[model samples]
Target chain A: MKAIVHVGLKPGVLDPQGKAVADTLGRLGFDEVGSARIGKVIELDLTGDLDAAAAEARVREMCETLLANTVIESYRIELQA
Target chain B: MKAIVHVGLKPGVLDPQGKAVADTLGRLGFDEVGSARIGKVIELDLTGDLDAAAAEARVREMCETLLANTVIESYRIELQA
Candidate 1:
């Protein structure tokens, strides 16, 4: 099975990297762009007989413990068999 | 409009960060994990009257020119109104 996680800053959190990108885009002639935010995607390959529910639960644990800060960031997970 | 871009290393590319994550997960007792890969998600807010197709095309250009390093990374773009 495969687990895909998308972790991003929570709303109202400041994102300097994203701000830089947006500013650069404006200078580069992409005037349509108003803002930008950057985040992380982690893909994990698992080898086990666990069912979908168990896998998702385990992955969520991983997020809370190691993968995400949880205070200023939020994460979403997707699983594939 | 909003554009979401997911950028990831190509299949054959080596990802040191992902390897470190996998190793750490193993040490942290996630023995089921076989491997991991890390990627980026960039969200952009756009202000324009352009249609969906046009917005997508413009964002693709942004990816090609600045957002993604096409030599080693591949990117997918999603648009939302």
Candidate 2:
């Protein structure tokens, strides 16, 4: 199985990196861009021993415990086999 | 239409953020963690004007021009309505 974890700063939070990217885009001629919020993608290839839900739960725990700062960021997990 | 752009550091490139996260995870008891590679995800809700491929192309251009550095990162685009 393979899983992808997408983590990002929640709306209304300050994101300096995202702001910098948006600024760079404006300079590059994409003036219509309103905003940019940057985040992280963590992809993992796992063995097939665990059921999808179990694996997802494990991943969720990983995110809550270590992968993301739940106070300022949120994460979504996608499972692929 | 809605689109998602996932950008990440390419393998073999140095990923200090990923390393830092992995180190943090290990300290937090996820010793099974092998490696961590950090990236970014951009989700956009768009109007219904452009076709999926066209929007994807625009996003790819954006990634190349602003969202990602071709030297160290690669991107994937997903479209939804």
Candidate 3:
């Protein structure tokens, strides 16, 4: 099974990197670009015998514990066989 | 309008950050984790008046020209109103 996690800054969080990119885009003539927020995608390939629900639970735990900074970030999970 | 871009390493590309994360997860007891590939998601908020198709095309161009490294990275664009 595979699990894909999208981790992003929480609303109202300051994103320096996003701001930098946005400014760059504006300078590069993409004036239509108002804001650019950057995030992370972690694609995990799982092995061993774990059911879908079990894997999801474990992955969510992992996200909470390490993969995402819960205080400042939010994550979405998608699973595939 | 908003455009979400998912940028990822093309298959066969080496990802040291992903490898490190995978190793760390294994040490932290996620034995089921076989591989972890890390990527980037860029969320762009568009302010100017661009129709859906035009915005997508412009975003795609931005991806190819600046957002993604065409040699090793592939990007997917999703537009939202």
Candidate 4:
């Protein structure tokens, strides 16, 4: 199975990277562009016999414990075969 | 409309960040983790009357031109409303 994790600054939080992308887009004549927010995606190729729910729980724990800063960020997880 | 862009190192590319995450997970006892690849996801709450297909085309162009390094990275785009 494969798991994809996405982490990003929470709504209402300041995102310098996203701002930079937006700024660059504006300068490049993409006048229609209003905002851009950047986040991280981690694709994991799992092994062994970990079941789906267990894998999700473990992955969520990983996110809350290490992969993301919950204070100022939010994360989403997706699983695929 | 909203646009979500997922950018990641190509299959053959080296990802130091992903490796770091994997190392940390291993140390934390996620022995089931075999490999981790890190990437980026950008979510934009777009404005204007940009049609879905047109927005996607523009986004693809943006990815090709600046948002991603095609030589070493791959990108996927999604549209949500």
Name the top lDDT candidate: 1
Which regions in candidate 1 have their CA more than 4 angstroms from the true location?
A: none
lDDT of 4 at B78: 99
Residue-level lDDT tens digits of model 1 in A1-81: 999999999999999999999999999999999999999999999898999999999999999999999999999999998
TM-score result, candidate 3: 0.97
Residue clash pairs of candidate 2: none
- Per-residue lDDT tens digits of candidate 2, residues A1-81? 767898889888999977887777778876545666677788765554778898898778889987879999989999887
Question: Model 1, B1-81: lDDT tens per residue?
Answer: 999999999999999999999999999999999999999999999997989999999999999989999999999999999
**lDDT (Cα, 0-100) at A76 in candidate 4:** 90
TM-score of chain B of each: 0.97, 0.89, 0.96, 0.91
lDDT of 2 at B44: 57
Each candidate's DockQ score against the native complex?
0.90, 0.42, 0.88, 0.80
Model 2 earns a TM-score of 0.77
Q: What order do you get sorting by lDDT, best first?
A: 1, 3, 4, 2
Deviation (Å) of B71 in candidate 4: 1.0
lDDT string, candidate 4, A1-81, tens digits: 888988888889999988999888779877667899998888877888878999899899988989999999998999887
Which regions of candidate 4 fall more than 4 Å away from where they truly are? none
User: Tens digit of lDDT per residue, candidate 2, span B1-81?
Assistant: 766788788889998887887777678766545666777887655554788788788778887777778898888888876
Q: What digit string (tens of lDDT, one per residue) describes model 3 on residues B1-81? A: 999999999999999999998999999999999999999999999998899999999999889878999899999999999
Q: Is candidate 1 or candidate 2 better by lDDT?
A: 1
How many Å off is the CA of A17 in candidate 1? 0.8
Clash list (residue pairs), candidate 3:
none
Between candidates 1 and 2, the TM-score winner: 1
Model 2 alpha-carbon drift over 4 Å, by segment:
A45-48, B44-54
TM-score of 1: 0.98
**Model 3 chain A: ten consecutive residues of lowest lDDT:** A20-29
Please give the distance, in angstroms, between residue A30's alpha carbon in candidate 4 and its true position after superposition: 0.4
- Candidate 1, which CAPRI tier? high
